[model samples]
Target: MRVVILCGGESSERDVSLASGSSVARALLERGHDVVLVDPAAAVPVLAGPLRPGDVVDRIAVGKEPPSSSGRERLRSRMHAALTGGPVLELLRGAELVFLALHGGWGEDGHVQALLEMAGVRFTGAGSAACAAAWHKGRAQAVLGAAGVPVAERVLWRPAADEVPQGVKRLVAAGPVVAKPVADGSSVSVHRVDSLPQLAQLAAEVRSGEVEMLVEPFLPGREFTVAVIGDEVLPVVEIELTTPVFDYAAKYQPGAVSEVCPARIPAEFAGRMQELARRAHQALGFGSAAYSRTDFRCDPSGEPMCLETNALPGLTAGSLVPRAAAGAGWTYPDLIQRLVDLSTR
Candidate 1:
């Protein structure tokens, strides 16, 4: 199969996406498949050959901020290349399957998916509408809640000059709340706040036009994530974090959080998590998604609450989906091959 692994969009998760694309591309190459790696943020550059594993991994460092000026200029040039019939879009045109390794912003928010669908390109992951619905936490919660899925209480807040919404007040009254961008991944800019004043302060600092704040009551119990590939649900992975929330640093920084695959929970509870993960994926109309990851938290009463669904979950070595796949007895290469095979179906 000739595959173009598209990654490194202009989202906050650019570095992570690049890492994922590299891993998937390397694995695909090992499986004897032709792979073209494209970083859309770089405007889909022309590559002479399959990316070297070492070079791909070393391309980007993990951090929260945007890329430096030189990096930004390079990306700008790349984007211009795509717009001007550059090698990126040209390569995509002749590919058998466009493997989407993109995360956050335009890549994961259904924008790129919509374009792909219009171009009649077969790609991995959910459809455009599903991506849009799943990209925003607030929207995902509403959709999932209506489908009878258990979700944590949440309040949405945009930039407002007046007063905090009543929903925000209600959420804060319950307990500490987790605040984050509705559409971003890798826990970027996520915060756990205890007071309304802190939320106000955080809200005041927001200047981005695209990000809307989502505040949900923080679940103090265990956190778990389950990955669904094709029709199978991988093992549940539990996250033990030293920090209050799985912020940007804790997520990408080594030794910041301890992860246990096939989380140390009762068999029945693990079954329940997997079931919810599947149901959540289906409820969001991601039945055709090549692969996806659903996150959940157990409330104080041990009831699982769906947090958010990811249409394009990370495929990096340290990503939760791979950990869960390992627990389910599938190698990373096996998982990548399966996903590629499923993309056509």
Candidate 2:
């Protein structure tokens, strides 16, 4: 099988996506599959040919610091060129399947998926519509809530005309609030605050129109994530963070958090979470998705609240989805193979 691993775009999660694509490509190559690595953010010259082990491994990043503003601009420019560049499109059309090892941004938000669909190219993970619905936090919660899934109360707002809306201010002023970019992942710009002033500052920054933000009641409890492949739910994984919030640092930095697979919780509790995760996936129209990972926060009362779902979850070794799959007795390569089969079918 010839697989084209599409990854690394202009999103804040670009570094993570590159690491994930690199890992997936390496695994596929080890299994004797022909793997071509394409980092959309890189220049066109790098978009062709089978990836060398050293090229992919050397790009693995451990830091969560997002690319600088100028860095982001350059990436966005290169990405735009790559998307329209003749060579990249030709490569996509030639692959047996395009393994979407992308996270966040246009890659995970349906843009790239839609393009692939239009070009009649098969890709792993959820469909374009499912990705669009899952990428937006506000929309995802609405769908989950309508399905009777527990979720924290949240409001989406862009500083209306450069002024923070009254409702948004009240929500932040009332008590502890979790402020985050509505469509981003890896916990970028995710903040927990109790002061109205602090929230006001965040709102002002988000008012730039480049980013839409969401404010939700800070759910203080244990965090857990479940990975769903086909109709089967993998084991639950618990996340313990040393920081006040599981920001980008805690996500990518070494030893920043502790992850326990098959989470040491009661079987009944784990079962409930797994069921809810599956429900969330289906409710969001991901029933036909190759795989997905849904996050949750257990309230102090021990009831689970759906956080969000990822249509294309991270494939890096330290990522939650891989850990959950491992607990289900599937090696990383086995998981990759399963996804490839599903996409090509």
Candidate 3:
């Protein structure tokens, strides 16, 4: 089968997406599938040759900080032109499947999915509606909470508002709170506020920016993520963070954190986490064969609370979903093959 792997859009997670695309392209090539890797943000999309292991390591290595927004608008403009009608669109339409290795921004937030849907193309991962719902942390929590999935108390706040939302104020008063962009991934600009003053500072910073934010009570418990591929729920992966929060640096930088697959928790608790992960995925209206990674952080009572669902999670060497898949007895290539098979079905 011919596959077009889309990655590295004008998002904060661009570097991560590029790394994922390189890895996926190599795996698919090894599996005898024709693969073309394209970074939509490029002035002219590159249909690179078959990728070798570590071929793009230096070129696409994630930095401690996300790519600067210096020329992002120009890149987005080029991306828009290319996707609308050009080599990229033709490639997408011609491929048997378009593997979305995209992480955040317009790529993973449903815009690209919607475009593909309109063009009648088959793509891996969730549908546009599901992606849209899952991309917004506040909305996903509401959907999951309504479906009986436990979630942290959160409120959506527009930084431009004169006063903080009442719900945010209440959460802040309760305890340390987490403030993050409502629709971003990879923990970009995510912050933990221990006091109203800290929140005020964060609010001021965000107010000068454009993104809306979500505020929620921070859970001090262990962090675990469960990946659901089709009907199969992979083993839980526990994240041991060395930093105060699993921010962008801790997430992408090597040695900043540790991931333990088949987490060293009781079988019953693991099973419960798996079930909640599945519930959270389905609560966002993901298709039966769609894949997602649902994140959880334990609360004061030791019960896990759903943090968020990643519709298009990272597929880098250190990503949690692949680690969970490994615990489930699937190799990296096998996981990629499984996703291709599931998407085709």
Best-performing candidate as measured by lDDT = 3
lDDT, candidate 1, 1-345, per-residue tens: 888888887777788888788788778877877777777666326432554333333334566453433465566455545634555666777888998888887778888888778767788888888898898898889988998889988878774546678998888888898888877788888888899888878877774353578888899888899999879989899999898887777877778999999899999999988888888888888875457899888788979899899989888878888888899898999988888888776
Q: Candidate 2 lDDT, tens digit per residue, 1-345?
A: 888899888888888888998789878877778878898788653553575434444448756586654577788777767766488888888888889988888888998888888888889999899999999999999999999889988877775466666767777777788888889898888989788778767666666556777888777789999999988899999998787677888888878899999899999999999999989989988865468899998766878899899988888888888889899999998988888877666
| Candidate 1 TM-score over all chains jointly | 0.91
By TM-score, is 1 or 3 better?
Answer: 3
Better of 2 and 3 by lDDT: 3
lDDT of each: 0.80, 0.83, 0.87
**Candidate 3 Cα errors over 4 Å, as ranges:** 50-59
Candidate that scores best on TM-score: 3
Q: Which stretches of candidate 1 lie over 4 Å from their true place?
A: 47-61, 64-86, 207-210
Superposed Cα deviation of residue 160, candidate 3 (Å): 1.9
Expressed as tens digits, the lDDT of each residue in 17-91 for candidate 3 is 998897788778767787778888886587584444344423357889988867779878877877788778988
Error of 3 at 245 (Å): 1.6
